[model samples]
Structure formats: C-alpha cells, structure tokens
Target chain A: MEVTTHSAADETQVWGGGNKPLNASYGKMMMWFFIVSDALTFSAFLVSYGFSRFKFIDSWPIADQVFTHFPFLHGVDAPMYYVALMTFILIFSSVTMVLAVDAGHHMQKAKVTFYMLLTIIGGAIFVGSQAWEWSNFIRGEYGAVETKGGQILQFVDAQTGKRASIRDFATSIASERTTHQSSNGIWYQDEKALTTVTLAEVKAGFEANPNLVIRTQQLNENDQKIDLSRAASLEKIEEAQLVVEGANLIRNEYGNRLFADFFFFITGFHGFHVFSGVVINVIIFFNVILGTYERRGHYEMVEKVGLYWHFVDLVWVFVFTFFYLV
Target chain B: MAADAHKLEIFRGLLKFKSNVQKIWGVLIFLSIVTTFEVALGIIRPEFLLQDFLSMKLLNWIFILLTIVKAYYIAWDFMHIRDERSGLKNAIVLPLIILIPYLAFILILEADYIFEVMRNGIVSWNF
Candidate 1:
C-alpha cells in the first residue's frame, strides 16, 4: 500500500492519543500494569515459601502454633484473633477508599474528604499492628535449644502437657562465658555476642527437673509434638549446641530459619506497599483539599489511587490465607 | 465510570441511609462475613475436612477457594473493576488468570521433586 503524501490521514486517525484504548485512562492502565508485575513478584515469594514448606513438610512450624500471641493479653493463647481483626480493618479501609472514589465521582468534596480520612486512619492502624506483631515474633515467648545438627529442640512438661519455657525451668550455671568479641578471636572476623543463656545451664536445668522432657520440632500424626522419655530427654540434651531466644534472619526459635526469612521478606514487602499506599493516599488527599481534581472537572485521580489501595488489600487477602490460615 | 454501578449486589446496600452507599455497606458486610467464616474454619480444623481428598486435604482446598472468593470481591467491587469496560478488565485479569495457575503448577511440581530428592537422595531429610 502506498502512503498518502498530503498527511490528511493524520487528522482522521483515531490512534493519535485521542482514543482511549480499552476505555481506560493512561494512569489507570499503568496502575494495573504495576499491579500485575507486583502480583507476579508476590507470587514468586509465596511459591518459594511453598517450596520450602514442602521440603520440610513434616517438620514445618504450624501457623496456629507459632502466631498465638495477642496484644495486651500476654499469656492468652489467642490464635489468629488479632490477625483476623487486622484483616477486617484492612478490608473496611478498602471499603472507605472506594467510598472516597465514589464520592469523588459525584463531585462531593466533603464526602470524599471524610472517606479518605477514614482510609488513612485504617491504614495507620494496620501498619501499627504489623509492627507489634514483628515485635512479639522477635522477642519470642518460649526459647529453644538448637542442636548440633541445626534442629530446634523445645522443652515440655511430661505431666502438664504444656510448653515449658527456658525461663521457667532452666537454672543458671556460672561458666567462663565471655562475650565472643572480635578482638579475642580471628582479628578481622568477629561474631555477635554469644547467647545470654548457655547450653550448660540449660542441660543442668533439664537434668535436675525430672518432669522436663525434650520435644522435637517434628509433629506426630495427631498434629502434636512428640515428647521424648526421661532417658532419651537426658541423652538429647547432650547434643544442645546453641541457645536461641527469638526470631532473626539467622536464628528463629520457632523452627526453620526459612520460615522466619520468608515471614520477614514477604510481610515486610507487603508492609512497605501499605506504607507507600498511605503516602500516596495522603498526597492525593491533599490534592483533593487543594481542589485539584475539582479544577480538572473530574475526580479520576481519586479513582486511580483507589485502584491501587484496593490492590494492596487484594494482596493482603492472599497473604492472610497463606501466612495465617494455611 | 460513574455511569456504571458495582456488580456485586451484596455490597450495593452497604450504607444504611439508602442510595448507592447501600451497595458499599452491603459488599463490606459480605466480605467481612466471608472473612469471619474463613477465620472460624481455620480455628476449628474439623476432622472430616482433614481426611485426604485427591492428594490435598479438603480443608486446605476450602481455604484456598474461599481466599480466591475474597480476592474477587476486592477486585470487582472495591477496585471498581466491575464498572470498567470489558476490554480493560480482560487486559488486567486474563494475564493473571493464565499466569498464576501455570506458575503454581510448574513451581509446585519442581518443589515436589526437590522434596523427593531430600527424602530419598544423598542429602539427608532433616537437619
């Protein structure tokens, strides 16, 4: 086909930015693009998490067992209650965000401001709850001993069938436990301070307390941890290598290091998304007050940001299922 | 976009004062109920659902399916995708629909293979 030299075709063409393909604005389409790519990124993280869990299918830490701490009530075993509340709040915030967008569509400025404010408050509360959760997970409730082979061995009372914490039964033993400093060791190579509670103290405590039994991380057919007999418990305590207190990148008192690693990376990544969503919402919130969308004759900007906010909530839905429930 | 209302009828009456706000409240209540149901099931872990069905337990499949339902409402109502033009909706959704299961199948298959290796091969199963 021969091209026209007059260039009159340019005037008649609908492809020159005038026509909105798919009837979506450029910004909305970009937001969807970001959502798809980001969704793929999260899928990778979760699937790899699935991979690790599958590898350790029998010994993987149960979500119900691990995330049992409740805020304010220290000793209560409120499994999934706090997370459930957080899920409700986050979903409600999504509702408020969409309400703001709906109000924006009707050019209702006051309504838009009100709903946007609610969304901001909801987001702040969710973020604060996550920080608290991380604190509890890091601080930990019951400490465990890491065996020489990198397996965690917890203590339990044979009679009570309740979890025995390190603080409860472990007796303190005076050993030449100097804080491993880089100065005394391999000049340039230094390690962090050794665990405050030494293995000797734990072993002595275990021997003295006849009721204390060793519980391996593996689960029995009934989904309960198997406890070693007194004889085996004493024998197992001899293999204790390190005393672990809480969760970190390298050590997790809960069980697997990979579990904590994925927990931090996936949740931390999601928290970052929520944080940025709040920041963006704030910017748009201010723009609404400045009559920016009003001047533009439409509140499409509010709608655009609302899409992102909802996407964040959608991601959390999956996170809640895989992380907390499954 | 304002010309079209939300597709999910349950959320159409979310606000008590009536009008379109009702839709918002309706949908919100629906989602919260679904979530509450999920949390309840998670806590209970009924013995019947624990029985093996096809390779996975019925409970896990239920959790995954319910989770997908929640995700749908968030996308359809909260994100206003239901109000969007068909072409745009397809553009955003079809790729994910095709990609997620494909990724799940492929990655999970590989993971199962790795699990087999750890169990039977030279590498010891537990640390």
Candidate 2:
C-alpha cells in the first residue's frame, strides 16, 4: 500500500493507502477492518447455533415460551416483548451515535456532547436489560424434571394450555434433600444451586394431579411439544432422575441443553462487546465534554467510534432474529 | 475526516430525508417497524408461514430477510457506508457477503447429516 501510494502520488494517480484510501482516513479504515472481522466471528457463532438447532430440530426449545417474561408483567404471557424492547434500545443508541458523528462532521461540539450522552444512556439501558434477561433465564419460571438421558419433562395443565410450575403442585416430602458439594460427591467440585423440588416430589405430584400431563421436548408434526397421555405421563415420570429449575453450563430446564449453551455463549459474547463499547463511549464522551476533539481540528475520533457503535447494533439485528424471533 | 454527513440515506432511493439527523430518525423508525413486524409474526405464527417451504419454515425465512434488511440500513446509513466511495464499500462488504453464506451452508449441511444419523441410528430418543 505504501509503495502504491508513493508511486500514485508521483504520477498523480489515484487509489490505495497513504493518508486516505478512497477518501477514508486511517482510523476509519482500521475500524472497518475490525468491524468486518468481528462480523465474521459473530456469524460463525450464530451459524453454529443454527447447526445445533437443526441437529435437535424436533426437541429445540421454542423462543416464545422460553423468553415470555416481561418486566412488571409477571404471570402474563408476554412472549418476545422484552427482547423486542432490548432490540429497540440498541438500535436507538446506534441512532444517537450516528447523530453524534453527524454533529462532529459540522464541528458542533455541543451537539456532539448531547448526542453522545444520549448514546451512553441508551447503551447503559441495553446492557442492563441484557443482564436482567440473563438472570431471568438462569432463574427459570417453570421447573422441569430431567430424565436420565438428559431430556427435559415439563408439566402443563390439560384443561388450560398454560404452563404449571412444580412449586404449585409438588408436595414436599420429609426426606432430606441435598446437592452435590465437596463433602457430598466430588472433593473439588460444587453444584450451581439446589433444585427446590425433588424428582420424587415431582413424580408424586404428577400422580396426584389428574389434569396435568407430561410435555416432552420432542415436537410433533404441528411443531409443538408432544403431550403424553395420563398413563404415558406416569410412565415417563418414572424415568425422572433429577429436577432442573433453571439454566447452567451443564443443565437447563429448557429443552436441549445446547439451546441454553448457545444462548449463554452468543449473548454473553455480544454483551461483552456492548460493555466495552459503553466503556469506550464514556471515555470519548468525556473527551467531547472537555473540548479535546474540538481542538484536534477534526472529530475523526468520534466518527471512528461511531463506526464501531453502529456495527454492534447491526449484529444485534441478526442476533435478535436468530435467538428470539426465528 | 471530510465526512459527508448528508450523502448517506437508507431504503435505497426511496424515502429521502432533507438532513442527516432526519435521515437517522427515518432509519430508526423503519428499523423499529421492521422489528415490530418480526415480533408480531413470531407470536402469531400464522398458518401459511407454519407450512414448510424448501425444508424450512416460511416464518423463519421472513425473519432472516427482515433481519438482513435491518442490517443493511444500519450499515448503509448509521455506519455511513453509503457516504463512502464504492471501492471502500465493496472492500468491506464483499468478504462478508461471500463468506457468511458459505460457512452457513457447510455448517447446516453437517448438522443435518448429524440429525439424520440420530434419527436413523439405534440410539434411543427417549433420553
């Protein structure tokens, strides 16, 4: 690139490196490279997630059922609402970021600062909402029993199509319940959290409730979970070995542990990006407030960061579709 | 940087805004509307979309298409790709346009094979 630029300048020719290639500055060029590479990385993660979903096509958890909880609307079926809100927050932040860049182009430091502040706020809200979503995912709403072969068995009311939690039905036995700790099983390993309802209690509760049925993770032709009859439900409940309440690296109340694994990995990676983006934005925000870019003769620095901010928001569009909508 | 703030506009030649700020809001509104549509389709799961098309759900195809639309506007407008020269635009976008689908194809094929094996093998599904 340096050789071409030198020769091009000598001949009054155009194209390739040396200050500006196609009129893009060095910082902006490097930012574009970073964005393209980072986009590929995210594409790989999402593609692998798709691969896993296809592998477990019949048993993959439905996004609507898993992400139904909405803030301040507990117990109401609000599927896809919270995630939709998060997506809006991120895209809105991207808007502010581009607006900041626009203001920078005109050398309007005050507008840049105002828009930057709004961008930071939007990013903060998005990151917070993601953390909240993760917590809710980890602390699942309806507990299910995990079979010895690692399939999840959830209980639902037959009369109404709504889900039923173990806490609502399980009658606690006097028997002592314990999770694996250093003293219990592995001398060095410990379990995440103890399951509140024991498998035995869940099994006993299924026997008591005639209206309840067992819904296997396996989907029927209708693309819904296969509902087992009373007798089959009793038969299936016998194979229950452990109670799974939430999600973790090892187990998930949601069907197909791979589902939770991809959720954690992809969203966690994206969340880390947002966190770092927010940190970078705060630093630049201070610089804008302090007239640093104003004195630099140009606000190219803000434009470079704006590229990154928009890229993150762009990735979320795909993530929102792959993880939630699709 | 000599950035041209007004050159970047979204939705192709359609829906041109007078200023960059207005264009940003226009893109934001368009993106929001697309998202709302995606969410609504996801929840409703209409009968026609539920029917399998080309071995995939029509609804999923719609989601993917809308996602790509949102991604394009975000790149072309918010990231100022449209304001960039064609050379720079192609340099950044060409690699992704070529590579992402290739990776997706191979990975999805492998997963499909794996699923076939599981379905046909002696391995029990009741676990």
CA lDDT of every candidate:
0.85, 0.89
lDDT for each residue of candidate 2 in A43-84, tens digit (9 for 90 to 100): 999999999999999889988889988888879989988999
> Which pairs of residues collide in candidate 2?
none
Model 2 misplaced stretches (Cα beyond 4 Å): A1-19, A179-192, B1-5
**Candidate 1 docking band:** medium
TM-score of each model, in listed order: 0.92, 0.94
Positional deviation of B65 in candidate 2, in angstroms? 0.6
Global fold similarity of model 1 (TM-score): 0.92
Using DockQ as the measure, the top candidate is 2
Instruction: Look at candidate 1 and tell me the lDDT of residue A207.
Output: 91
Residue A325 alpha-carbon offset, candidate 1, angstroms: 0.7
lDDT of candidate 1 over A48-106, digit per residue (tens):
88888877776788898789988788788899999999999899899999899888878
